[model samples]
Target: MISINNLTFNIGARALYDEANWHIKPGEKIGLIGANGTGKTTLLRLIVGDYTPSSGSISKAKDLKIGYLNQDLLSYQSDKSIVRVAMEAFARQNQLHTEIEEILEKLETEYSDELITRLTDRQQEFEQLDGYNIEYRAHEILAGLGFSEEDQKRQLNTFSGGWRMRVMLAKILLQQPDILLLDEPTNHLDLPSIKWLETYLGNFEGAVVIVSHDRWFLDRVIKKTVESRKGKLTPYAGNYTFYLEEKGIRETIQRGEFKNQQAKIKQEERLIERFRAKASKAKMAQSRIKMLEKMDRVDDVDDDNPEVNFSFRFTKQSGRHVVNIEHLNKSYPGVPILHQADGIIEKGDKIALIGANGRGKSTLLKIIAGTETFDGKVEAGHNVTMTFFSQHQLEALTLENTILEELQSFAPTYSETNLRSLLGSFLFTGDDVFKKIKVLSGGEKSRVALAKALTADANFLILDEPTNHLDIQSVNILIQALQQYEGTFIIVSHDRYFLDNIANRIWFIEEQKIKDYPGTYQEYEVWNSKRVIPKPAPIPVKQEEKAKKEEPRPVMQNAAQQLKKLNDELSRTEREVETLEKQVKEIETELADEQVYSEPARLTAANKRYQEAKAALDLAQQRWEELAAGIMEIEEK
Candidate 1:
């Protein structure tokens, strides 16, 4: 649907892409990935015509529609409600519907055949456009993106910047254009919303190209991977995992070839130098020099991956119970976030708090950290020193302070060498440490905050979305550091892969309660799948007695027939529940595989099927329980 030939783009004097060629076909989902500042977002802008390439050409079908979601939110009507802005995506459909309405009104006055034909044609067009379901689909998309019904009714300006970005995303998805260009779509979404978006994009019937730093999300939504680096574009036919493997192999081969060519060149040079001084071998030396001059030199392979090394050190140990919460309740005016919640955090326990947006995940973290006030009791165990990191931590830094100064402020006694060494481990080296905090990007600021947190000699940590602005590599480094720390921590993050690797327990906040599941993220998912079946309500006493009385009557024959019918239904429901449970387990197992997670289509299909089966199993189990109760009542009589 879109084609690029010999595309060249430059930022100032540096060329980001040179003679790059790529083609995106219909229904293809492609991931645009690379390290930060590699022009991934710039390339998307060039494709969407927001920026022109320095040279070469890009083309697309003349009539094809393109939906582009930029990393930065566009200026929209702030006074409009969220739903109103989203529904604007269907402006053409809305226009057509209005025309149809006008035609129907005109038909009441003029009964001419021409008028009737025009009305009929317009009505057909409206129906063909699916105008009737536009509002319903808009609502579905908005809700799936984490907008509450009340939130949708509020003015757009009332929302935070992150939520406003989500509104923009909703508008783009609602448009359903022939091609989708998304840059960091999941940056503002929670885990549940990210899962919903994965499902939506999986079922999308158009071409998609997305630039994101979210490794797990990219693994679950994209079919192909395109990497941008060092003025070149490299296409990998498979997903991110395949791309990684193929890239490794390519780099290895290139290194080998480069080494071989260098060795050959060195040998030839030595031979030429040694023989050039002798009159008898001068001709041979000249020939060797010429050959060396004409030889095609192999450029040394550049290492694109850089490592960040750091670890946390604790000065003291906490008690067995790091934190204890009893009868925790938090509320604001008309909203109740948490109610009568209790939880215990033991030493060395790494807990992940997860839920949809505005579900009290952050609030609970604050309450536990004693940063926010609540009407409950929260106690920290003996010798429990704590460090808290939040998005606001980046903003809390003195903007005028250099990176070195920022770290020194936290630990004033640390020498210059110590501070620089710690900063270097977080990817800020030499002159980078001298840059003012105000000049740093979001990712850089996040690194500074993380470095400070790591240097703190606290044994308890509370981190809220610590990976928000960090790239994939930095997140891995943080995970490794956290893995080695002998501290108790509670983290709230949307990065599933990070949580899966770092968290040993799951603390899920839902419906005003905190439920603790004792296992890793993958295990929690498997257990939660089976626990979705709610307990059946108790049978009414009068209904049970009625069944008992009818069992011994002349209606005994009817009772027997009813019993047989209930038995059959119970058997069918039980079979369906068992089958769905098995399917869910199988999919969960597949999802646990790193390779399977990289295949977007397979992952999406498995997730969708698991959800469907879970719903079916829940209902079936409920019905089966009801039927079994009925049979027992009949037998008792």
Candidate 2:
């Protein structure tokens, strides 16, 4: 447990935190949320002793261990394999293992009673520490974080920054520290890896404080919410959703109180104005003025959520078919991205392109934007104008130009006044538009690039991870902008909440083909959770003949009879699969419940039932597939 008492931190003259207090209790899951530049990460660092507060103190329980994960870990590089790197978390176990090995080698040559005793002691400690299973635990965590077995064996330096960040996260999870301070932990994680981490943290015994822009993740994992704003920390008793509702209620009450106080002050002033000139009433008026001055004024609520007033304009409306792809084939070296993948983006189609990392989501986006080389045709529809937005575009911004200048150059048709107004909506108000691009942070630069991308006279938008560095408010503004736009767009983002609000269709790549789900991301998730695995490919002629020799085929009176029998069996199997699937879902829901997960016996029972139901579902699906395949064969004949 950690207690931050009257913590005041300042960066030069600006107080990032002024008497901000938060008590992180054991086993509590807290989400630290605020808009950009509100010092969420700085608070985490303050708690971890990386930065000392200007005043007050951050006191921690004696011998408490803390693990901090931040974006800086993305630069970590090592020649060692990822598994070896992750195993470094178990320092004591590794040391004991080394010592025990040395003792065994010594006994091979110079055996003695003292050496044997020492070996026994070390072996006992090693067994107690579970040293033998450390490597296996490390591998399990790495796999959960999205590393393949082969990837685990590869050197860490071979991976990109995002992948390297995942390695650092794996190492931290392996450590299992008493307190986890994660700053945007989901920034580099894919949907599957994020889900895995959510499950892992849900069952984590220690306390956790997370700073993230991901609302869906926070809603799923965090039990408490804390907002950092206006040099103060405000606590909410529940998750983000609860915080929003509670904050709204508080704001309404505050507004009422503010109105009542203002009315009282006005009435007092009117009385004073009417009677102050009379010598007899001067003292009473002066007394009332003093009381008014001493009254604590309730501050009005801050407008963190800004409305999007700017609308996208295009030179010409795009044709009904915005983009058409035909047999799209793209690959790199040994990695095949899309093979004969085909998809169409019609007018007003807001597609959320998503999948696990290394699934070529970005590659597909670039291909559609006409920026990447591919083997097949990716043709733009008639009268279509396009604009592409990616993180790489942030680097394309001219450092010497001011934010306003950058936008002006990008959209010459728009006047300076309109550009400034547009910039204001992106959180650059007053003199902020005059700041040089070089002085901006990564998030600021991303906003500038996004502003340019959105302001373009293009009907088709290709946005790849636009919500990467945006805060929740900024993402909401984007959602608003996209909602108002009639143009078609395909966006690649891991932010589920953002996607669910903006996308009307979900697009993902599976088996190297573009797959489209005609619904929102939330609906796609439900469908995907129950999607059945496809049957295996047909055997070759030689293998089929060998199988025929090894096994006897069932004889039927006629093809019609065989078809009817297979159809009937398939129908029965389908019903069984559905029942088994429902049973599995029920068990999974129970396992997800806090009461069941927190109780060992209940958890064990639920897990057992889940496994049994899953096995039955798999068997039923296999039979269904076989029956359907048999029906297909007979019908073909």
Candidate 3:
């Protein structure tokens, strides 16, 4: 589709791409990843002709269609509805349809071979443009991005900037260009929206180039990767996970080459020194000097190590249960974010908390970590040391302290030089160590916050969406390092791929509640899939003597059939009750339990027996419902 031959671009003295030769097939889904300021964005801009390269050329086929969504993508006015803005992408296709209709109308009155052929050609074009499904597709994209039917009719100007970005993404997805380019597309998306995008891009017919900080998103949507580093764009086969292992292999080869070249340089240096003192080899020295001067120097090959991978070796171990929360209730001004949320994290547990945005995911983390106040109970394990990383953690950094000094304070046992070396693992090296905390960018500040929290001697790590703003490389580094970590972790993240690789259990937060799932992330997904219709096949009850004698397995079959029938009814009743509850909440005022006008003893007794006799699967599903409720209450609070 698009190709770059000998591409080179520079910012001041730093070269982003130096004579880099790279090409992407027409339908390839490629991820552009690298360290900060490595020119990933610049390379993307060059592809879209937004910026000119310093040298070399970028070639593209004529008549090629491209849809690029940059960080500064245009947004609709707040006053405009979401549907109106998203419909703009289909304008060209709509016009083509109109023209085809006009041609057909003309053909009804007058007929000619030439005119007939032209009409047929226009119809084909309209079909190819998906003119028939344009409106449907537009609505589908908007709805998947979290815009409700009511929201679609609301004025766009009334929405926040984050929501406006969703409108921009919906427009891009609707266009269906030959090549789709997205930068940080998942930043504003909720779980459902992210999943929708993954399924959409995974099957996209056109070429795709996405720049995202979401590790899980890249692993699912991208098929290939083009990474810019050390002044070159290196190509890798497969997705981000594939690039991870492949990049390790490539680094090994480069390291071997670097070593061999260094050995040769050292041998020549020794020879030149020895020859300088000998008159007999003066003629040979001239030849060696010419060889050394003409030799093309090889670039330094850095070590093949993950970034921001600081070790957290605590002096003491935590007790059996690392952290616990009971009946947690929290609320902020204007809305209730959480109501009666509960959770528990034992030693050696790696838990992931996931929900939609503004659903108290971070709030749950803060409450558990004791960084924020709550109404419910929170208990730490015996001798359990805790560390936390919040979105606002950068505010904790001291302006007067250097990077080295900050590390020395918590990990003070290590020498100042050693502390600086640890900071280098997080990309703070040499003069960067001396720079004040206030001088760093948002991403850099986040890295520093993560480094400090993870490096401390703590038995438990409470990380709230730690992967936000981190590139694929940095995210993988943290993923691998965390997998090797010995402490318990309660992580809240939208990156499903990361959770799949590391988390042993799930702490789902939603509504005004928290629920726990005892299994891997994959198992949780399987359980969640079952919850939609609840196909939990109950165990067959024992057969009676008469039934066993008459028809053998009839009793078991009858019980199984009965269970299925009950389950069908249960699902229907549950949906009806849920619908009624929503309607009731909307219409009736929230009254206290005392205002129910019922005897407390009878109500409590009836609910207990009904709940106990329920299926085990439904009982296990309580956590999800509670979490969902917590999410709702948290937002309301």
Candidate 4:
């Protein structure tokens, strides 16, 4: 457990936090949430002691072990195989096991009672530490992070940057520290892997503090939210969705009170000034002014929720069909990625495509966007304007240009004043406008790419994981803006809450096939529930047919006769319901009697029992109806 007190951090006169306090308790799962550049990540660094606070004290238990996973991963280029590196987390256990082996060998050679006792104690300690299951635990953690069994033997250097980041995550999980601090843990995870991590974190025994932009992931795992914004940290006792609703209600009340106090302050100031100018009332006015000076002013904090304001002024209206794909098949070397795929993008339709990572979701987007080609038909509509943001969309930006210049280059006719205004709306402020794209952070670079994309006025937009680097607050802004945009969109994202709230339809991509559901993602989940059950047969076969043929036989007749035995069971349930209903009616009759009202305790007890009996009767009636309906529906035919 840890607590931060009176933490004030300032760099070059810009204060990130002033007297901010944050607390972490054992076994607590918390989400650090805020808009981009609001100091969420900075607070994480401060907690892990990665960055010392400018002032104030961070009090933590002396022996508390903390594991902090920074965004810029330390490059894991080494001779050790991936499996060995993953197993390194169990180094201490392995060492203890080796010592136990040596002690056993020595015990066999020398007979010393004291030495034997010490070795016995050490063995018990090793067993208590779970030294035996270390390797198995490591393997389980590593595999959950998307590492294939075969890839375990391969060196870590062979993996790409994203895969290496997963390996780093695996290492942190394997460490089994007391407190785990993860920053952008979902950044490198595919959809399946993200879901896996969510379940894993939900059941994690240790305390976890995660900072991520994925709202759906947070909603599933975190039960509490810690919002770091505007030099303050506010803790809410619920998940992401619950926290949003609570924060909205709280801000509305706070803003209202703040406005009223401000108006009162102004009125008091005017009256005090007017009375001070009058000659005779000077003494009373001076006392009132002193009271005003001593009174605390309620500082007004607005509902500073970020707005998206997507102004995509298109150059021309797209054709009816924005894109069409037919019999698309592609392969590289020996593996077939997409097989005989067909899809279409209609004008003004917002479509969401979801699939696992490393699959052909991005590849399909490329084929449709014409950034890459396929073996089959991919047609772009006539006179259609198109803009695409790839998963690695930042690669498209011209790093040499300033943020303002970047937007201006796309829309040359627009003045610098208008360009700055546009950039400012996306959180690119005065000094940020002058910074070259080369020096911008990943989130900043994304804003730059987004600004240029909107300025082009493309009627069709293809966004691949656009919420990757954004925070929760910024993501909502993007969602509102996209919802208001008047154009067709084909987006691929793993954020289920976002898809549920914004997408009109979902295209579930799996097994080289796409299933289109004409509803929100939440509805899709409900529809998926039916697909889980085995469908009922049109008619009973096998045993029923054999029974039908042998109906006249005595043995078949015997089976039918046995049905009369179960009739007693059905009758018993029906009778139970009738008995309970009679009991409720008796209770009502007793309540109508004057003597029953004289005993308050008896009346209360009878009412409780009556309620219970009524519930039992309702359930028994439902069950009886279901059994009777099934028997009648099958036999009446």
Taking all chains together, each candidate's TM-score versus the true structure is: 0.79, 0.83, 0.70, 0.77
Q: Which structure is stronger by lDDT: 1 or 3?
A: 1
User: What C-alpha lDDT values do all the predictions have?
Assistant: 0.79, 0.84, 0.71, 0.74
Clashes in model 4: which pairs?
none
Better of 2 and 3 by TM-score: 2
Query: Once all C-alphas are superposed, what RMSD does model 1 give against the true structure?
Result: 14.3
Q: Where does candidate 2 have its weakest 10-residue lDDT segment?
A: 536-545
Enumerate clash totals for all models, in the order shown.
0, 0, 27, 0
Candidate 4 C-alpha lDDT tens digits along 326-404: 8888744433456787778788778888765555677777877887766888888877888888646789788998888
| TM-score: the better of candidates 3 and 4 | 4
lDDT of 2 by residue, 421-470 (tens): 78877779899999999999988999999999998999999999998888
Candidate 1: where is the Cα deviation over 4 Å? 99-121, 148-150, 299-301, 413-430, 533-637
What local lDDT does model 4 show for residue 342?
Answer: 79
Checking candidate 1 for backbone clashes, the offending pairs are none
Give candidate 3 misplaced runs (Cα > 4 Å).
74-77, 93-133, 155-162, 213-216, 256-281, 296-300, 306-310, 313-319, 328-341, 370-376, 380-385, 395-415, 455-458, 480-486, 510-513, 522-637
Instruction: Report the candidate with higher lDDT, 3 versus 4.
Output: 4
